[model samples]
Target: MKPEIAVLDIQGQYRIHTEFYRSDTPQNTIILVNGSMSTTASFAQTVKNLHPHLNVVLYDQPYAGQSKPHNRHQTPLTQELEADVLLELIEHFDVQYVLSFSWGGTAALTALASSPRRIEKAVISSFSPLINVPMRNYLERGRRCLADCNRTQVGNLVNDTLGKHLPSLFKRFNYRHVSTLAEHEYAQMHFHINQVLSGDPQCYLKATQRIEIPVLFINGEWDEYTAANDARQFAYAIRDSQFVSVENTGHFLDMEHKQASHISKIALLDFLKPPAPVITRPAQRLSVAL
Candidate 1:
């Protein structure tokens, strides 16, 4: 089904571009939150798996994808801001579940930590709440490349580091996408890197501990950007959560060139499916009338 387009106004902050894929027999709603360098288009494969089961909402954050900034003056966007946007979208669409990838998971968790109006469950992939030393160093290099205004270097840096573990096709695709980013996108990238650099692990732990809903956290076995160990640690903090580490996969699990993507997609579909209805047979009775 063709998704209906909508724009969400976050008061005076910024406007978001949203696409709603309404299920034919909708039971509930789920929101797809994009990563730092990712757009709503990144969730194409994901949406396909979910469209049949639940109403899906896809959106781009400000200065990313189709979403534009509010003014010419460049204001650094924060995870807090992204979290607020998620909350507003939740209220607007009456979303009951969240499925976020990469940095988008941070914002989604932040929103949940703040005590959202309503959320039943959440699933996060390729995300780690805390940025450890090695991860911070890797992110710092990207920040430096962005500071130098060398989009090519920025793309190469990721490929040389995290993308090296990804499948060949996905690596080439990522390089091409990043190297060709528009000028405005660099500004957005800078903000995202800064957000990661400035993130406090302690706060993230607190946030993870505070989440009340059931969660499913998935990470690639070979993922260096958001290591499986970190993802597992955070998942353990939640009262009700499960962690799955996909073998032979890297940061980009669902986009892999091999069966890994299919494996991850199947796991996602299984998790997001609504509970099956119980069919109780009724008692038989004899008719009194002849």
Candidate 2:
């Protein structure tokens, strides 16, 4: 069945454009959050892979995709507000699992912290708990390119930072979407980077300590923005989380080569499976008189 598009009012302040793929007998619901400068389309393959067994939810963040455009002069966006928006969607769908990529992972972490029990499990891929030096440098360059309205530079930055990781066949596809991003979307992406960098560096680290649900961190072995070591450290901080590295892949594992994508899908499917219900022996009847 075709996905249905809908709008959700967030605290009456913003409207999020959401897409839902329903299943007759879904094992669980998976909400896929997009990365910076990306839309729900980013998860086309992922949705196709999981729709048969899992109900999928996709949405555009504020100033992204079909959502309202952002104003450059508006107050800086906060992860807290982003978390609230995400939590609203989770509550709306009664979703148990969340799958977030790249920038969206920050929001997912924040949401998990805000409502520790709302999510049962999460798969965070190509994301870091905190911005590392290399990521910081890349974002700084992107900010300059966007500030100058240098589309060429912006395109190059996107290629070097994100596209370089994709397989040859998928490079063109990745570039096409990056090229079509609106100026407002670029601005919003930059704003998100700034918010994450400026906020508590240990925010996600601290959140990991409080989160009770299981989380899985999937990073490409060659991911430039989020190093394998960093991903491992982030996963280690969480009480019940595991880290997986997709061999010979980069940041965009979901859209990487076929083999990489397949591996990622399998990992996600295995992780999303609900845990077995705990059973205990029935209480024994009281003995006579004991």
Give me the candidate number with maximum lDDT. 1
User: What TM-score, over all chains together, does every model reach?
Assistant: 0.90, 0.88
Q: Candidate 2 — which pairs collide?
A: none
Candidate 2 Cα RMSD after full superposition onto the native fold (Å): 4.8
lDDT of 2 by residue, 1-290 (tens): 79888888888777888999999988888899888778888898889878878999999887777775532225545667888889999999889999998888878888887654557899888988657788889988988776666767777787777678766666676667666777766776667767666788787788777777888999999887887678777655688888889998988886878888889988988888866789999988987763
Query: What C-alpha lDDT does candidate 1 achieve relative to the native structure?
Result: 0.82
Best prediction by TM-score: 1
Task: Report how far residue 68 has shifted in candidate 1, in Å.
Answer: 2.5
| Per-residue error (Å), model 1, residue 94 | 1.3
Counted clashes in each candidate structure: 0, 0
lDDT of 1 by residue, 1-290 (tens): 79999877786768889999998899889999998777888888788778778899999888777785533337767788889999999999999999999878879988989778678889988888768776788888888888777978988887887677766777787888888776767777787788666756667767778888888999889887788888877756798888888898888777764577678777876787776899999999978987
Residue 107, model 2: Cα distance from true site in angstroms? 0.4
Error of 2 at 262 (Å): 1.2
